[model samples]
Target chain A: MRSYRTSTVVALGLGLALLGTSAFAEAAKDITLLTWLGGPDRKVLDTLVTGFQAKHPDYKVKINVVTSQGDARGGMRTALMGGEKPDLVTNTWPAFRKELADAGILRDVTPVWTSKGWDKSLAKTWRDISTTGGSVYGIPYIFGYRSGIWYVPADLQKIGLQAFPTSYDDFLATFDPLRKAGFAEPIAMPAKVYAHSEWFETLLMRTGGPGLVTDLGAHKIAWTDPKVAEALRQYARLFGAKCCGDSKLMYATHWDDAADRIFVERKANFLQIGMWINARAISQYHLKPGTDYSLGKFPALGRGFDNASIIDAKEILATGIGSNPDGADAFLDYVLSADGANIIAKAGFTTPSSSVDASIYDPVAAASVRFVNEGDVRFVLGDLLPGSLVDEYRLALQQFIGNPTEANIAPTLERIEAAAARAY
Target chain B: MSAVDTRLPPPGARAAHRGSPGPAPGRRAWMPESATALLLLTPVILLFGLSVIYPVIETLRISFWEIRGLGRPRFVGFDNYLRLFSDPVFLGTLWTTLIFTVGVTIVAVTIGWTIALLCAFAPRQTSIFRLMIFATFGISEAVAGYIWIGIFRPGDAGLLNGMLSAIGLADLAQPWLGGANSALIALIITAAWSAVGLPLLLSFASVQAIPRSILEAAYMDGAKPLAMMWHIMVPLSLPGARVAIFLTLLSSLRAFDIVFVLTAGGPARATETVGFFMYRESMTQFNLGYGAAATIILLIGVLLVSTPAIAQRTKGAK
Candidate 1:
């Protein structure tokens, strides 16, 4: 009887200890995230979130997907000012990060960065883009390759071009043969606000090399530089030569249609866009990459000039405004870790942040890796300016492209300068 | 004494009694009644004050301020207003809105009046056609905008463009929404199409109420078809016509969805109306103060233009 009683007491004690641990585990932290996840992307995000939850069962997250366009960030700003903000927000444009920082709504995550070793894992370019005032505010979630020329295999074959050109003179020469063959337009250029901005970036990169744009974005260069004027003049020359489509059509036609004309209809030989352009072409036209089409960097300017590409990093930021601030930081840490980077790289995205191995990504994404590491890519322009100034510059570029004349250029540039000065 | 007074009360005594008054009622005496009426109307008054009057007042107040999104609204009195006046886009939008309003009003009212006249004189089975015609008014403006977009899509894949190409009129299949000059006109056509149904229904109701005997008498007195329409049907339908015009004018002035969805005030802001401008300023630009100021200006312009017409129509009705 003594032996039985002793055994029962031991079992009960063990049971009580397990119960205490289980209860402690059940006391999970909760977080709220606001994002713009819709359609197929929502499923991918859901999978990622579920994976996150499974790994950290002690933390619970609730996501609120807000459906909006252009006004989503503005609405969040209003909420931040009103003292009601989400713990995390996705799809934040770089221009507004300054405003949020200025407003003191964002949390300085430099400690989180150091603790998680992200400072060592992330690429310097990615770190540079996501940092403000020597403190990290966000993690680079997605990297988009923006500087490249798109062409059809058939058009290249017809023009006797063996491969895509890598120099400005050669690039212009390729277009001359196409124009001489009586192709109405060798390229499809849109005068829409966003489209015009892309063209301006392309011109800036092609003429002065991408370093000037990077310098301008970093506030190391002035807008009134002679190189800037030369770039504008080069764009005007192309506009005058009828190498591009009607400017009016630019206002109505979307970028997809422009891609369609280049890829499907074979109307245009070249299109300047980002990596997503290639993805859109593949999905829209069902064209196999490396066979039907391929990618190339924006041609080099001259000797000793580096072939510079444009890089835009999508960031995940932990905004301080809800329950479980620690949980938000934990989730961000998880995303910036090597494991999360592997998941993203497997999904056909470039993960240059040294956390993820390049061998894990598909060939297309691996190409982006090469572009960033081998090609020495730089961040896009207009990212350093305030949101209002960026909008004004976009509008000014749209106007200038539509009415490409020497008369309109000075006034447009002057207006942009005034807006930029006010911005600072 | 009572019987003699009752039997022999003279005009002089009655006049003196009637003329004698204890007090005189002046305009000030109407105050209490007016106050009671205002009090009774307080809910509606408050509603107008909140939704309409307050916004106008706030807009006028903010017009003098330099307010960005969710920031401290700073007073820069008249600077914004001055900038707006000097803005070419704003001026262009004003002109476009005016032209669009007038163009849509004329087309919508004319077609509606014609349809209503036909429906009034048609056979019994024509009620189905009338119903079908009037059914379009049930659709929301955004839906109507999208539907017309499918029809007027600039490419050959569009419904109208495909039809024209199939019928061997391919040469005429130019970009309908792609041109600056034709974009506003196309939007005007869409606005007319969406709005004509309401006026048609109103005019049909008024036309049916006209006395049939008067029409028969006119026919018997050797009235031709043209004369019968101009003299009999038109004159009787004038009241309905006036209401229809007023409604269409108001609708045209406030039209936003069609222009927004179809053109987005684009192709170089050629199709921008005051309503679209106000929305872009308020929502896209996040310049709520400036947007408010623009809204007030638009409201004042609309009221000034429409007040005389509304008063004239109301007086005519009386």
Candidate 2:
């Protein structure tokens, strides 16, 4: 009886001591951030929080995660509509940012941009892309190169090519020899939902340049525009080259399955995707970058838009409803600082801020940064379209992949046009 | 029917079957039976109105508006419904939902009823097998969907394709979920496999409820096993089968999770049902009015499927 009483007292004392210490160590002010990022991306956010808390000992970040699958936009909208007044939110979709801004959910940070001298670190292009209706709303901290083709160096060697193809014709020419070398389909096209559009989107940039992508995404140019049809024709050219497997196989494959075909199975030679494939290849397949595999920019189509690039960026947007505006502003500034940018680079993502050193990134990510610097970059087209139009556009694209002939291109473009008519 | 009931009932038992009492007019203040019954059910009535009735009314109200993506809703009256009827995607979903519901019901009920009849012959011997089959009913549809994804996955990595190659039938192996018809078929097969467990248990209970005396009489009359089963067990066990059909039809009409996990209403929306269409509209596109209209349509479908069975049961009770 005596021992039991003593143990209970000791347990209560320890609990109180731990609670008191935590209470004392707590920061005086806090700002909340809402996001749907998980896995390695979540870890990156945790690291940023640590670095920020250390710098601003009196301020803290409280992260509210909205758990979701597939598209995170739906979950974010639900959280906001359900009355979650987060101070900041990590966003990627320009159209989504526009929606939030139109709904009075986002705050214009142009004043912060001018006062904090953010133009020295971020380029004009980042600011321009982050702006909606002449008001800037977010800070783009990390970006991924979307136009690169992921391939094993050895697969190209199998067909006796010392390097990846440099032109569109040369790239298509490798399929026959690659087939002869026991690779049935040189490219694993994942049309299960969306990844197959990566090829077509880049081809659009190649054929019509970034301006056409911008115009078509905003429906300023109808989907039936000649430039759009010509881009689809260019997309059809890859199918004419016998580049992928049957329509059924493509329709059944997802991005992860295609990644397996490239890395684990080695049954295919190339996959066009964003920079997340680099992390996936390194961690999941345990392959080293630049040694076992490397990224190649999409082959030049020899159009006037040969230098254009397509990319996706993760941006932090300020909200209009939070109480801790100061804490949120300080966090945004720190994200662009040298320390924050380096932490991002260390986590295997490329940062847009000039403060980040190129040496901190892995070879693949470094190449992506170099490629972005070498071209005019546009956000990935799918992320720029409204929600209503985007679904219809992808579904129409799916139908086109089923039969990628010249005859099918016009009808496909018309289908997307019909949806865009109602979207706006 | 009257052979076993010739004995007389004692005292109050005779009058008990006829009436409790017409009215308590001669007694002290008394409450009517109907009124007393309603009083007893008040809590349940209120609970039902709160839990089930209010949300349905709210949904119907929302279906009349034009609510789009957190935007201010304008009352559009019947425009959303009119749009749904004309929309090719929604029309396609109705057709797909019909085919999916019918396909799942036919496949599940047939297999379950057949297996249950066979299991009735030796319940003790097949106890483990019956348990295993019924256990599948307890599995979550989402988990079952992922398991089928591995089986139906494209290329040689998939189990079905691998088995085909092992059997020297490699030419027959195709992407089961890639084509339109094939994906719908695969979805039906998965839904039926998941749904069969319930019908099996229900039909088996009904079969077990068959009186032993009848089976013995049929056997003593030199009836064959198949004959006794066809003539005796089939008709007697139909009430359970009817209930199972009503239930399976209701569930299959609202099928979403399996389709979501399996095909996601893809390959150009070939396998999309009304439930998935509702989700895509409401949750994904944030078209609350349009999605609510779809839900109300699905609810009507469920009522149509269930009304016949319910009417027949109600008539029997009367």
Candidate 3:
């Protein structure tokens, strides 16, 4: 009888030990995160992950850095389709987010959002974009003002400009003195798809405010609107006046090359690009922001319209179909917490929904914040379009830049509209 | 007739008497000798089925559907085909691919043939030259692309442009890769440069194996250098030239890596070939069904154009 009782006790002890070890193993799960965070951005993300791991001490986060934006979106789609999805993914464009939601790869984060009371921390516009079908699907990570121009400080000082222009007339007037002072080209305009689109979008916003692009993206307004046509005409006039470099040269060049010419060669006094371009310039050329160069909102078009621009949030990390829901929820909470936001902000990057103090930023970020707070900035137009329509627009822009004409513009716009209609 | 019948019966009986007479010499010659041959061939046949035949069949099957790498494939019949006709980018890529193929094939084969001839006829120093030229074949296509990119970069900091400027030819410093008109040409040059060494080495080996007696006899007959090259050497080396040209043509038709790394079908799609377009559709856009359709189109094009040349070369070789 004693032997039997001891045997039973031993069996129970073994079972309990096995269960405890399995639980510990389950708690130490490794999660894969797909992101485009490399270089300095990668270092920053690694620090944040380290912090999270220190607090949890049970989970392991493995990050796979995708080299390009295109690859990240395409790879995620392929992975989800193959049922080999990552635990978390970062996507830049809203179209991708919508596509993932439509495909049911994204977990509905509404409950998590509500449980965590994340709504109290996020802006309404950001929250609206993150929600689909009245349910939250994604969280915004980093945000930047897209429609802006960079100018060399020396050029601005030489031209007797005290500060960046706040209105369109003053913007053109500043260029006139630069042109008269023997600066053959005052701006370096790349005829790339995104570059040209940004130029046109900035011009439209300056002329008619952010409503024009927003309406166009929402299909409430046509591309052949009179304001758009006038904007195109103005773009052509600027091209003819040599206010920008050769369109063909620009079309053939990458954005980085254009940035290099502005920053290194001093061939052009100004360049219009996104904040990511600023990051690239600073990293590549070792230039000090606000000292060697300065940032300004894209020049305004007319008096009635306020200084307006476009804002684009970088991709957010979200749970995929194959993720451990509980662990993913924990990570999401960590990301939304004040600690995570502070870590990202201190690394010289901006989080979309985070309430970061502007005083801590460099001059460019501070200026970008001022513009976002004051100007009527809308979301990027292409990001708002359907994926198919975005591709169509990119192709159309390429074609237009290759052979820009009054005769070609209408047909190109018509083709794009037809494509957009079909997509919808 | 009576005598012949008698002899045939006698011969059959004699062969039966000679211990099966090596199992009828004709059968022995027709069949492979050992099980090892079949064993070795099995893996090759299986690989051919899996890599070559299966993908072709799967691509054709998927071309008829509306599959986009995600979800179930929906049969769309002729819609995908109809869309191909209407796709302006596809049309443009087709033309560009054709131009690139013809241009690269002609350049590579001609240059390779010339180098082969030099290696065959030139002095001992020509061996060094041959080795140097053949060394390029050892380099990967990606490395070749980067080397050419460094050479053809448009800025004043570029190697070629800087050299030209130093030589007081600053006026000649044009954007070699910065315009639609020049981008394709630049890509073709890089492709030809990267591909020349393979054909050159192959042709050189074939030329070296040519009977020296034939060449000596030609020399004895007072054949001039050009006459020997054009008439005697070329006709004899036709087999090698044929193989070289066929390889060059195929490589140029399917050229992807160099163009991908260097131009990526850019400069207003001037360098966009069918291969690059298919890659973008499948890999970049995640439009697998469309990519499959494009791939099917490319396979058909290659087969239709190349089969005849390959067959003719094989027949000539035999």
Candidate 4:
């Protein structure tokens, strides 16, 4: 009996030792991600995190979501202010990144980029866009072409256009024919908020190219510059073509309603928006890409920057306040890995990392990839603009849509310029 | 003890101090009336301080600093207030708020009082109708805004436009929320619809309080129904209607959800109220200091509207 008790005590000691070791191992730091992303975006982040956790079993990713009604940046700022010390944050707005950087909330990841040899996966241009004040703070993982126009192929056939228009004038010329084909509006302008500004932004890209976006965003070039005026004049030409319906109808429409007009009601022909609409088209409407709907590049304006495009990209930034910088850096490296990019592509998104398997993209997403690869790309102008100026700019554009005339353009530009001056 | 001696002490007597075993264990000993009152009010006062007073004080403090996004704040004093007054957008919202508040109060109170008087004549028959009207008050303002969106939608698919077309008035059928004037009118109509319930219930209660003797006397005097309604019921029910006007006016001045969902202060901001302006500045732009200044102005406006009503209500109260 004494021998048996002694043996049992030894066994219990071994078991307790094993449990204590495991408890120590499980105490490894968790990499918390603070984001305002929801729906499909949350699903994508969750997938990437699962892949990351699988590769690094010692680390776990905890995603903290900041919910808001509109303009999620407010909620994000609120979360940070409420003492959420997340290791990583997903940012889309360049201005917001600057704000965070200025506040010293972000860590300069320039050294990590070189130490990890990220240059092999991401191009120099991505690095350039991710930098502010000559220091890199984030890694842009996913991008969407903002310069593409969404169209239903069958509807184009009705207007006697065998394919989407390839030139500015040709695109405008098709409007009359589409209207003649029993459509009330040729192009649905969602002027209720900011989508109405999309056409003008693309026109600006065509007229003044990427340099203008950079200069205007920095307030280096005034809003009254001839280059900016020329862009607005080109936008006015859409009104001249009678491309959209009455100003009243345009003012009443939002992006979703315009999408409905294009897909559900079949009352309108085209909409220019970001790539989320592709997901919406496939998932919400249950439509096939390239067959039911397709995307075309904004028609060429015969400008020097005709080959250039605009895109919206989401980047992951490291925070200084995090407890686990090593884990956060490892996660960032994993995000740009071949496995990570492929996972993103398979989820119906385009990744900036060239390590992605190109075959994973659907035809429409493939087209967006092709168009973006064709030339230099800039972040969408709205995302580049300061928060204070963005609203006034959108409101001015909204007012312009109310009366899209040459007379209105000057006042509109002047109004935005005044706001910009104060904004800077 | 004798019955007279054992009788309860007169009100405010120090009964507990007389011979109360120094009050039971774990219970309070004798205290002055004011001390007892203070003890009773302590929790409520603390709660009020935390939820209401603290926020107001913090907001006032924030108004003095210029906080832009995550950037460090700078003390700007009253520059933000100065900027708001000079701002065309803020000034425009003030004008719009006045118009919306007055418009909603008149429309809701007038319709509600009329219906209440009409229902009072046939209380049993109109019970379901009264319930149906009051049901709208239970509906959330945001939900009501969404329902109105379908009605005021731009196209022929919209309910109002379809009804107009069905009635051979297609020429008059236009996008109800597209134009500045029309959008504001639609918002007012929706708000009034949501607000009409309270006035109806209040006025009905007032009308019910009319003595049956007085009504019967009027009836015996051969006074017509219209004469009784105009001379007696209308004059007597003014108190309830006045209260309704005051309430609806305050609610309308602070309208945001309906505006946000339906119009978003759009078509050149013709429908923006001071409340929406505050939200846009604070939440959207992260102009905390500027937004806080706007909030303070709105608080003052509310106080101005409420102080008179509160004074009149408490005129003879202890």
Candidate 5:
């Protein structure tokens, strides 16, 4: 009986000591950052967080990676409604910002922006897009240009093209001769949902300019509009080229598979993708930057929309509501500064902050910075639209890719318009 | 059957009269039995209330609302259900669900019943074959779907296409999942392949339970193999077969993983069944109310399709 009592007392004391230690650990955790940063993306984020912690040793930051972009968005939505929301969330897209802001689950960082004097450093377009009803909900972290064409410069030289084509006619003219030069397919087009949509979106931007793309994203204009039909016709014209081979080939190909054709397998010459393709080509395929492959502007198809670039800033850092708003703000301030941006640049990612010098970036990233700095209007396609409607748009474009005909385009657009009408 | 039996004491009274100091029939004899039954049923009843009853009630309640993501759910009355009739996508989803369920249930049950009968008459050493066939039941639905992906994948890399080309039937090796019409067939084939194990095991177990005396009698009475199967074995096994049918039907109606991994309801919403639609609405699109409404409709469909078989099973149980 005496031994039992003593053992119980000892066990109770040990349990109390362990519980107190865990409590201390919990109290010492200063902030939590929920992000979709994984694989190579984590390197820069980890460096920035470590730097922040070193500057302020009293603060300990916890990082929770939510796997993918869509999962992170969905998780943040659920976490906002539940307890235990993170202090800071990074890589949030514009699509989720307004909804979170409206739900009052996001803290307005406008005050932080003003106090830090960040309004002058951040790009005006990003600042405007991140603002919802005059409150900035997102802090721009990482940004880049999307829908840029990637081609092997040597392949282009072999086809007797001295420079990348700048106009629609010149672009189409290169395809046939490139095919005749023993290139099987001049362009590797993947009919996967996102790939097909990006192709159509690029064509639409060149055909009807940014205004039309904006209205479509806002759902103010239906997809069945004549302008959209014209864009579809243009896309079909390119897709039907002999240089494209059979559209059936696309059914088995994903976007990465299409990219592999040029960079890895050396089968195709050109691929229309984002600026990130350059880094992928360098790292994955071990291709030299200017010699093996290079970036070119997606040629302007019409007279009005000239040299326009659609930029997609995929990763945005924002604060959660009912969280440690002060800690979140402090971390955001630290990360958006010139020093922080340079750290991110060193890790091979571009930043939206103008305070970061263009020369700090690598040559490929420097080219993207030039696209933004050279008075090119940046637009994020479908950023304002609801996610479901965006899905409908992609699905419609995929169907059009499956069967590209004059007869099928109108009905496909109508179906997409019907989905858009119900988005609200 | 006779009114005079009411004048006599009930069965419990006769037993109680023979015993000493037990409760009288009119007063408290049933109390202890009832209490014991209540005690025994408590855990399952609590579980049923928690898992099945609560979610069902919540789903029914959410069906009348318009919920977007984790936003506040607003009551829209029957607007969600009423919109179903007008929404082309929902209507098409209903058609896809029906086609998938019917095709899978028929094909799986037929294969299962056929295999069960064959195994029932086979030599005793062929129990290994039964084990091998039933091993598929241990595989998860998602893994099964992935296994079929290699077979139905749409190029030279695909196992089926590769096999066809090697056998000099290259012209027939087209993209099997390229279009809506063909994608539906692929989904059905994959679903049936995964679903056959349940009915096979159930039918075999039930057939094995039949006494050998009946089979010997039928054999001695000069009943041929076909006649015995038609009139004896099949009739005896109908109860288990009906249960298997209902089980397979419900599972096929709720199949999302195989279709999700295979077609993703693509080639223009061709194979988008009710289950996939609900998932897309609730999880993907974050419209909980619409998804709830779809779930309720699918529930009604299952009940309507399986209620008769359930009643028959009950009668057979009695």
Candidate 6:
């Protein structure tokens, strides 16, 4: 009789232990966030996750960081297709949103936005970029000003150039003397397609005018337009110049590596980059912002749109279709909220939401914001164009840069036109 | 014993001579030997059907449809193929692939064969030399690509260009991976560097398998080093050499990651091969149907490239 009594008590204890363990497992809901952010940018995300977990003690956030955008896109696509969706994923702005929506991998967050009234806080352009076919698939976390050219004023002084060139012709002319002064490449350019397209689109916006570039990105304008061809020709000429560096080295160098040339090694006088470069400068080059360097505008080409800036709003974070979407939506809501935008702003990212206080931004980011706000803003052409056309543009531009001659210009344009025709 | 002829014969002899026909009182009915073998092979057959056969058939089906991402595919019979045939870029890519495959196969086989001959005939340090030559096989293709980038990198930082400058041949330092033909040449060298190991290992094994008596007889007949290699070792090792060349050709035809990491089919699509084109169309562009069509075309090209080697190997075997 004593043995039986002991067994009953032990059974009760085991049952209580099992129940407590299950309750503990249910307390902290695991939410996975996938992104391609690295360096200081990754730290910013980690801090945001910590803030979110602190605010919502019942939810635990897991971060999955990929090193490159291409890998991130492919990985997310596979995961969604394989039925293992990440709770939240940060993707390339408009392009990935369109692709994911078409694949039905993205959750419709329009209702979420309307419920929270978060759509009202976003810049109209950013809100429009996130919505496709009447559904909000993503929210802008950061906007990279692609028009900024990083230059050391001292380097320009050594090359006998007193000021940055504001006009296209003047910019082209500066290359010769800079080369003569033994600055073989006045500008450090990465051969990467995305990097190339940033400058290409900037040139297109300044030379072909924003209207035509917008039309071209939307497949409304033919790629063979004489104005478009002119832009390509101009871009080819600049790329082939002595100041653009050796085609071999430029083609082989990565975008981040090329940025390092100006920021750390001082190998080149200027680097065509954006606001995110500051993050890289601080993290990798150990350089101070504003004091170490400053931002300049892309040279104007007199196409009726002066002071226009190129913007890449590629980091659009959103909830995916799977388990813990409510939790994911809650996190994105926090990220896009005024408080969340403040966290992002303090971390040196340019938040698209106006609700966030702007004073937390560093001088370089503040300058970018002021320049973009004061001037006309346009999206990167590659971001707006379909994938096939983007690929064709890269191929055409790279080929033209490879052998930039007057004779090659016509064929390159024709080839690009042929590709554009098939995009739709 | 004659009266008890109902007794079974020796156990082994009885089993070898006759099969069981009916069920014993306590057991189930006997199955035929062939039927049992088929039953045993069922799991492998099912796995092959699920993994390999189903995908190939699905790809063929999808080749006739237009797929934009995971959306419902619309059947577009023969259109993708027609587009492929008419695509100037795809045609250019095909030409590039041909050059890449033929070039890598010929170069890798020749070099591997030459090295194998040296390893076979050398009287001293054969194992050490063999180890040194075969060490490259241990490196991955991606790593091999990065290693070659240092050599082929443009400008003063590059090993090749720096060496040229150091030797007063600075004028010859041009971007090895930037020009039209130059990019293709650089890719071929990288691919050969990655692929040569297999052929070397195989040819070495083949050379070792060659009966020493035949080589000695050739030596007795006054065969010199070159003559013996050309007349004796190579002819005897043709079978292994054929396999090595075929594998190299196959790998080169589908080469994607190396070109992707190295040139990305750039300097004006100068190095764009069919494999890279397919990846761009399918993964990058989300045009799975079009990519499927390109994949089928590449498969056919591979089959055409490998058919001769296979036939030769078969004839040799017979």
The top-ranked prediction according to TM-score is 4
lDDT values, one for every candidate: 0.72, 0.90, 0.73, 0.89, 0.76, 0.77
Error of 5 at A142 (Å): 2.8
Could you tell me how far off, in angstroms, the CA of residue B179 lies in candidate 6 after the best superposition?
Answer: 1.1
Instruction: Report each candidate's C-alpha RMSD, comma-separated, in the order given.
Output: 9.2, 7.1, 5.5, 4.6, 6.3, 5.6
* Candidate 3 DockQ, CA atoms: 0.34
Instruction: Please give, for residues A239-300, the per-residue lDDT of candidate 2 as tens digits.
Output: 88999999999999988888888888888989998899999999989999998999998999
Which model, 3 or 5, shows the larger TM-score?
3
Candidate 1 per-residue lDDT, tens place, A304-374, comes to 44455666666777776566678888888777667777777766566656778778764555665676675
| Clash count of each predicted structure | 0, 0, 1, 0, 0, 1
TM for every model, in the order presented, reads 0.82, 0.90, 0.86, 0.92, 0.82, 0.84
DockQ category of candidate 1: incorrect
The weakest ten consecutive residues by lDDT in model 2 chain A span A21-30
In model 4, the runs with Cα more than 4 Å from the true position are A1-28, B1-29, B316-318
Per-model DockQ against the true two-chain complex? 0.22, 0.48, 0.34, 0.59, 0.21, 0.28
lDDT tens digits, residues A106-134, model 3? 77888888898887667666676666557
Judged by DockQ cut-offs, the docking class of candidate 3 is acceptable
Give the docking tier of candidate 4: medium
Share of native C-alpha contacts between chains A and B (below 8 angstroms) recovered by candidate 4: 0.59
Off by over 4 Å in 3: A1-30, A36-41, A64-71, A174-184, A218-220, A303-307, A353-360, A402-408, B1-38, B68-72, B121-128, B216-228, B231-235, B313-318
Task: Report the C-alpha lDDT of model 4 over B39-152, residue by residue, as the tens digit.
Answer: 989999999999999999999999999988988899999999999999999999999999999999999999989999999899999999999998988888899999998898
Q: Choose 1 or 3, whichever is better by TM-score.
A: 3
Q: Top model by DockQ, which number?
A: 4
Model 5 CA lDDT for position B208 = 83
How far residue B201's Cα lies from its native spot in candidate 6, in Å, is 1.1
Clashing residue pairs, candidate 2?
A: none
Q: Worst ten-residue run, lDDT, model 2 chain B? A: B20-29
Candidate 2 Cα misplacement greater than 4 A, ranges? A1-28, B1-47
